[model samples]
Target: MKYYNKLLLLACLSGALGACADDEIAAFKTDKPESIVEYEYLNAYDALKTYVDRTANPHFKLGTGVTESDFLSKGLVYSLVCANYDEVTAGNAMKYSSVVGNNGSMNFSTVRDLVKVAKGAGITIYGHTLCWHSQQNNKYLNGIIADKVVESEHPSEPTLDPSVISNGDFEDGTITGWGGWGNSSSRAISAAGQGHNGGHALKITNPTVGSDHYFVQTSYNVAFKSGETYQLSFYVKGASTGTGQVVAQDANYAGDPFLDKSANKDFAITTDWKLVEMKATVTADRTLILLNTGKYEGDLYIDDISLCHVNTGGGGGIVTNEYAVQSDFENGLDNWGGWGNSSTREVVDGGGYNGTKGFKVVNPTATNSWSAQVAYDFASELVAGETYYLKLKIKGSVAGNIGAGFQKKSDYSGRGDFPAMSVTTGWKEILTSVTVSGENADRFLFNVGAYAGTLWMDDIEIYREVKGNTIPLTPEEKADTLTYALENWIKGMMEATEGYVKVWDVVNEPMSDWPDPTQLKSDPNHTDTENFYWQDYLGKDYARVAIKLARKYGGDNQVLFINDYGLEGSGNAKCKGLINMIAYWESDGVTRIDGIGTQMHVTYSLDPVKQQANEAAVISMLELLAHTGKLIKISELDMGIADVSGTNIKTIAVTLEQHKMMAEYYKFIVKKYFEIIPAAQRYGITHWSPADSPDNQNSFWRKGEPIGLWNLDYNRKPAYAGFAEGLSGK
Candidate 1:
């Protein structure tokens, strides 16, 4: 009967309908076969969020971590997230390092765009972080807390022959007086204000460290008389520790070199600028002072080269208009000192009015003019009757006023004041003449504490105004400054988000596991340049300060959480430490914390015993969180499978059985989250990685691991069904 029905339909379709009528066609039916079900069954379910029972867990939020660009494009990832998750936490866009620039300038455009798009999709944003040790503007922060420089009361007299070396300071914006080549080396005059003395410097780049230091040389031709003593001096620094020397060469450097004509005066160069001086009697009439630095395998800088014939008459020469203090900040905060109030200071590059380097001071509040100060000691006391010229290029993030003056170093007694200046956003050259009326004034001071925003100073020079000053911050002072910095950052971020971001990880990964797992991370060695530990500077109260600021700026509706990883392992030592620390932070009774987050980055073990241990740890972690009576969130939850050999299985290596096991593990975790925590304290779970990690070594989180419910191709994996079932309480 089935064959007849098939034949009839085929014959009618072929137009051979002589024996087939409408009634016959109606009777040409055959029974259908049963369907086969496989992995495809997982796709039949709706979006993951649909399975959550809102009535059972009214406040539970289904969240995912996402990249800002992916979500902003409104592409596949965006649609998928919006359809599946109720909230999103940006992977890095909202981080402290991402929002704050190296100049301490806050840029919220990226964050604002993110909020706008997320708002349109009706997805709430959870602020990933407000404070963290890693990925911070360490250069700026460290600069602020760096040791203050106080110039020597009697600075060494100028040794350079001012007239002998033309363009020695590179102020002509070119390497006019210097020449060199070899060892794949190159040279150029650096940008304006990159010099040791506020103008320019010769920058040399050597790709290879050749056998001889002369392989890379910078030479200046100067006439020298035989049997006459001459002093050659220059300020130099290297990008790394390097070796070089100043060699007196014959004018005929083009030919093979000979001994006796060369004076090999070697120097040990470091990252810090050093004044290098060499004195010798010349044997050649036309001497070439060669800076031999070929063995240095990085960039080298030279500024203010001076070669002078030392007269037996007891003087190199008169250096009229010599600077007492000339600072461009290219060598950092050298010769500058500051203290008082909560203001922080640093020498920042390319933040000056002329787009060069400058000294930056961030004052948290305006107070007494002298409360936050930056000063320089004169090499010698100012001439009582001499009129000194002072000049500086200054600007501020906002309009503000600052005071500058000459003062007695011993007591800070006023000697005289330069006309008080008001700073605006645009760079303004401040020029003034001050006559020292008092005999004992030995320092120049700037009262910057009176300003409430960022201020930058460049080319700060006191010509003949001189004779010629890391005050480490006191522990209490360090805390105050850091607290103000924290509040400023938090306030800016909160204002940018416009209160749409209701929740935040106020502090991330604050506790370290080594030395003492319970203690905060502190690296006195500063191994990582990007890391800046606020707790190391602010003490345990760092977290408390962060919470207070978050509440103040984030509005009353904010939900704050202190997030960390490895909370489920190490026998929950990190977890316990965090809870104990939280109790301490709130001991004052005024600081209220909203919740705690455990990052459950787990692995599905093939070994039965290891798997049991994993399950036990998770159960214990949940119980610990439950005991706190605070909202509990699995902030960053993802899983990878381990093979029988205990090695992590990459996505490509995951077998079907292993994949299913991971799925089961996901289900267990989600189920426990709901089963253990009370309904009211449930802050919900976030799938940190929604798709399997890519097979790329550079991937930041669990690279190449099969750590997601979905495959790389967006195909639903068994883990998806497990997660759905867990959410549905099946």
Candidate 2:
């Protein structure tokens, strides 16, 4: 992290001309600085990219950036990449923040837009990473996992539509608040038989009056109001063959019958439970919804009584505008896996619509890939020839396309990816319409990801338009959310582009020097406000999950890897921690982790003992990784001079003697990589700063460090000779 400091942030906030100093500005002149030393071996061999793959035991790849605005604009940079590099990794677009927005909406336009360009040129795209702690959409995620209050359109003026009926099954006691008229003394709440849920049912024994078979209730008051519609549904049964007609009116004992007389439902009330329902409107103000059982009955039982307001309809008491919810995803995903494995989908907290617990699905980047989806049985609930509306709250690692539809369970017949929705960064309300033929409708499956990474879903509801209240889910529910997030995310990315992109840096920078446990470094640059640490919540096993996700998503052929920086430092915890991760991953039942990336951001001048110490430390680290039989890659190799102190420092030109020595270090590092690590275990090498000069004042590495193989004018530098020689094994 060059020129990265608190001062830089403060300067940007104060609207200063970047955090760089005036001297650095002067150092970066329009005119190219002439190199004092001329190299003899600069152009005698093939390009460094060709020479490395041509002579090595491994068919090594050369990767460079195509993220800079002028990557192909200067013509030289683009041609250099096209001619010399085997693969190009976008420095920023491949990162997470580039796609996810501030509101947690993922817009993969940045990624998709570039991938189109790269693919058109016949250049391959190396997925820089799948999961990492840096360059994350912290602004979106922090707010996503933050404490929130879900909004519900409940009646402000206290109303009663108990989510659950009041002792509907008579679990407590049947005659507690319930007393009937006309030979009601013989009736009582009985638990001698099985109840609806567990026990207790209202039993009406033998009755005397033939017409007064039974009458029920303490107060004939229906807990309802005017200007509202209510649906009364209940369960009833009889001992032997019994006959009865239950009436639900404005006090069936007397007063006006709110429901039509012809609509009165008749029942046999047999030995089995039967469901009967009546629909009516208050019209005017109301007091009670009375029920009278007419005719003969012996040993009758009633349980699970419910009186609730259904979705308000138009005039004429027609119950048309109602919806049967398919799933809320509140309780875990039980019968919700048909598209793929259930392990690929999970219910997580704090990601729901209206801030409730929801689910996270693997959403890949490609639109034509097998996506992460789950099933919800609504076959019995859906009405044929009726239009059903699906509503869900979703967020993703990147902006990807998605869809949903009602499908058959027996034959798995579904209009797959029919109802489309656009997934963004924030939890957004997406609506899709599915007209149900009401046949074999087994599940309402929503496909997530036609791009990259994981898609988070919450408050997944399929219901017709209705005004009501739903309970909200929140974060802090459990730790399963974080763990499952890693799982689904990896699978999503791998499944999306498994054909094109093969290699991925699974976990980036997972070691910290500041913390005691020395786990992952959280937001290394404290100045960047939108930084998220997966390790902070998931802890030590974060690496394990990353490897697992990569393996599961990318499959056996996927070149999965764990990458980190500062491996050359003397006994640095980052390097040791990386080695430890590899061991833990392999030993923890992991069979796939293809390689390890040592980001060699080395310096040209380490002053005597420190230089030797750096060399020994890197060689030891390489040897240790090689011993594991895992491939090793020099992920981001760059050499810098002109010390970058606490504040931004000027890039003063080093002596010609020092420049030659810098080139020598390049040769030495490459040579040591081949010599120490087994040829079969070599992945490849990469250069960070491809040009000798820095164009952006706020660039990632130290600006104007002359670290590239080519000079500002696109001429081969002395370092190219050293790199070429190292490749030739000279």
Candidate 3:
């Protein structure tokens, strides 16, 4: 019955054994099952890419996702990919998160090597992404836009004036208005007798050193005035020898803070009470006092903290007046309204002239300067003969003049118009002083009916200036700075791949599927260090900006695409959402998007009803994509078998019949792609998983699943024949 018994029988017949039983011979003569014979036909096909009818669809490319290291090494993966695909997209090497570092530096050695290897082998390279919310260098991006850290000189002596910050002595035994950020830091009020001076002390515990010194921080909020020097004094020490610093920053945290003293800012902390005192000139009406120990490791104790406003003898001290009206749109639209002249106005995120939310106005045609206008109603009438300083940053799609005016809301009386200012494609600041003379002017308006293009306005401020002093950079300034960063990153990437890479996914997965289908994806908190949503800061026009930058740097011949996944879902919700978003992005009529990509990471459902529904969804997706008349690419194609319970079938758990089903599903996907999409719009189909996934639980993509056309051992699979049959239109 076993292998040894059959060998013994053969040996006995050949005189190597004493005896042999007829039953043992008969036991080895069982017939092979017929079901497995069906898979033998898979051996009949040639290499996967050979079945493509290139002459019929010359632009059609057979692509595969590959690891950069495997291809660069010219190993087995290199041989297989080159023999079976026409183009290669590096799975991760070409992404923004791969090249950009936490310190905002970029390294392209891997990309350059990959390009050289692929070019030498006659394989085209496709750029993976230019902009996306996930997989970004969040640390660097956030640091650039973090609450500014303006350093003030260390005070030689402690101030005798009353403290401006509340509960500076920690005598109340509460950590109210005191908090910590970064490095998983926590704060509390120490035991009553644990204070540095026999009273409760503010206790801060930092777990580890962070990338930046400010990453571990303790902060308190207090009102401050521009140009007014403030003295901050505290007694503190750490459980162990460590270092820390203290600084003052404006409450308006749109831009980076100025540093007055970097070398002398740091102080060594030991297990002893030491007096720490510093002086800083305030900038904004509100300020945050920060105690930074991000680079240190251990617990910190502080007591008797004091911050006092330094009173100068001069009668003309800095006077801080709150703006009568301010709308950064960081929170939301601050009740701004506009309607006229076939023009529309709305507040959009990441749609700012720089990298923040801003007011956008689009005019159909040039008419009266006042035909299209945006207005903000002031609660109180402007005092007669009082000078109000109005400042705003504006830009336009085309050069034109926009009129600014003040008017009374009651009878449209007291209309006073400022001089018309010319606006160009680049952002320009308009600062003017207007003396109110009308009996009552209760509203301010931006008249843009004469501008026959899209206009963007950010950081609008109207206030009476009582005194001049240095203030924190406004929202517009911060947005502009961040815009430069985004542009520089894109430019660098384009230059690195300019030689052989002509096609790019300029924006990847820009739209969100939940809450609102047509809206762009954004993470306001940005808690994940690996995710930095450019849209959160740059606004809704992020994709347009990416496309424009790619075109400028990559040249006119380059093909750009917007790519996303889940387009083939049942309701076609994501597909419809993406289509609408694309329409909105192209509304300008100049930011041309060349194509769309649908990542078909599909599953072959074992349930009968579910399989039928999946098939219908795939067809629907292809039809919808074809209707757009744009080049449609099957960007990432892979297949896995799903059990009746919707759990993914592991590679070892998959049976021959299940493999056959996945093979047929693959055929259906490829066949419908060609049948539904016109030849002109058929960009190509790419295999995301070329080989069966390994039995690794920690794999990021389709872990331990049989999703490939080939087995892990490089053997052709049933799916290979099915894919070939689909390509040949069988």
TM-score of each: 0.54, 0.48, 0.55
Which candidate comes out best when scored by TM-score? Answer: 3
Candidate 1 backbone clash number: 13
Q: Which number leads on lDDT? A: 1
How many residue pairs clash in all the candidates, one count each? 13, 19, 8
Candidate 3 runs further than 4 Å off: 1-38, 151-475
Task: Summarize candidate 1's per-residue lDDT along 1-730 as a digit string, tens digits.
Answer: 0011233344456555533658778557644322113464664677899888999888889999988898999987797898899999899999888888877889999999999999998999989899899888887787677655543344335433223554565554567657877877889988766778565788999987899888888777766666666777779888888778776667676322222224445677889888877776766565677778888898888887767666443222223454668888888887788888878889888886567778998888889988998889876787787767677888788766788889998876889887556575667666655677798878998998888888889988887622212245577776777787788899999999998898999999998878676777787655566588887788778888899889888886688898999888848888888998889898999888899999888888999988999899999999999999999999999998887788987888777777788888888999998999989899999999778888776688888988777777666778888898889878
Q: Which lDDT values do the candidates have, in the order given? A: 0.79, 0.61, 0.77
In the range 599-693, model 3's lDDT, one tens digit per residue, is 98898998999999999998998998899989999999998888899998898988887787887888888999889999999889889877888
- The stretch of ten residues in a row with the least summed lDDT in candidate 1 is 1-10
Give the lowest summed-lDDT range of ten residues in model 3.
Answer: 1-10
| lDDT per residue as tens, model 2, 282-315 | 5555665545553554566777666666554222
lDDT, ranked from best to worst? 1, 3, 2
Q: Please give the lDDT score at residue 235 for candidate 2.
A: 78
